[model samples]
Target: MSKRLKQLTKNADKNFNQMIIGVLIVAIGIFLWADKNYFFWPPQLRLLMNSEWSDIVFICLGICLLFTALTGNRSRKFQSILLILASAAVAMLLAEQVWHVLGAHKVEMIMAVILDAGLLTLLIRCAYKN
Candidate 1:
């Protein structure tokens, strides 16, 4: 194979891997949404019951993955910060399970996951770019 072709192939492989990771994050969000109880919202917004924050997070992750697939830049860190926040929220919700406060703990968890996913994507970009 030509030298230029080899470089292209290598870059493509890297981009593909990044995209896969991004997609995996989104997939997890999908499963979380499917659980029903995890998806929480106000009665007024109940019509969009399934359209939870986690779903939004998943979409953002998908967008990041798409960007990685196309540009391989990994420039922004916003997504990474978002993911970390989401994970922290999940941790809080899990703790609430033991406490059983009957509060909006589950909602908190969902929000956290969404934030975490975004942070995660940003982290991935940071790792690759700098």
Candidate 2:
């Protein structure tokens, strides 16, 4: 490989994980912001009403993730815990979306049950992990 290319590759390798995490965080933040602002034309049903506090939670999580990424703290335990929490939040939100799209029925119930069970399993594993 060319010297310049090799150097670029090395730099990317060094920060790949952090870069990915940072990008995901920023992407999620943008998604949340867009949802709140109704960027999705015709707009799907709101998971939380405009008066709910969940928007603030999303904003805060996004900011924290971005900050962590910018600071290059890839191995922080706090970040891991935050991610776990976020995963649960995502699962719950997804269940709501499923309900919205599928309506109140068996399909929604099955999906939500599976999602919640998976989330619970993940939480248990994370808690017990050394």
Candidate 3:
């Protein structure tokens, strides 16, 4: 690729929003894992410790956020691997949530799977993109 093309690609990959989101995800994960006394505006926003699933899910998302936030200027191969791992974790988390909600039957499980599948496909495509 041309020098200008590479520079543009690098700039595009380095998003401030991704970094901010990554920080938030990591902070939330830490709070959940540590069981800190953090409080939200509304009472409903508080996360309960009914199970460990949420803690695992948040950590996975935080890792994905880090991958997205820090992969800038890295080699394409490295970015691809990180993206694949992150996407897999996200997909697995979604699948697990769907499995748990199956008993409720309040939401459409098939739709959730389809949406997650689409997200996985998009992530894979992004990983392989030049």
Candidate 4:
């Protein structure tokens, strides 16, 4: 096999491993949040409208933005992550403040799920692509 192909193969493996580590770190952090509160710290489906969730969502959005800015080759991955973060921020804001079965909160919730799923898919793709 060509040297370039071998180098690429090795690099791809390293990227795959990094992605696995990233997934595990995120999963563990989320699990820790759940353990602490019996749910995510931000508390989805807020009926009382806690401002704390908004803060957490904002932080997540910021992190997504930072990742997108830092990783140019992983634009696809971070683009989806950014969408998810945006949806999360909107959903948390609406769910906590709006509080209705068929209100803005519902749309936020739907967008959150769609974007999150897309983000996961992008991450998976990026993991394999190197």
Write the residue-wise lDDT of candidate 3 on 34-77 in tens digits. 75432222334344432355666767665665665454635666
lDDT of 1 at 24: 59
The per-prediction CA RMSD against the true structure, in angstroms, equals 7.2, 7.3, 8.5, 12.0
Ranking by lDDT: 3, 1, 2, 4
In terms of lDDT, the best-performing candidate is: 3
| Candidate 2 C-alpha RMSD relative to the actual structure | 7.3
Task: List, residue by residue over 1-130, the lDDT tens digit for candidate 2.
Answer: 5976776566456545534444444454456555564222123444333323555565566566555545544566876766666656556555554554466443534654565456545544533451
Q: Which scores greater on TM-score, model 3 or model 4? A: 3
TM-score of each: 0.42, 0.48, 0.45, 0.31
lDDT of 1 by residue, 1-130 (tens): 6976776566567666555556656675677677655434344544454456756676566566545555545544654554444444334434433232244444435555555555555545544553
lDDT of all predictions:
0.53, 0.52, 0.55, 0.45
- Residue-level error in angstroms, candidate 2, position 107: 14
Point out the worst 10-residue segment of candidate 3 by lDDT: 36-45
Which of the numbered candidates is closest to the native, going by highest TM-score?
2
| Cα lDDT for residue 127, candidate 3 | 59
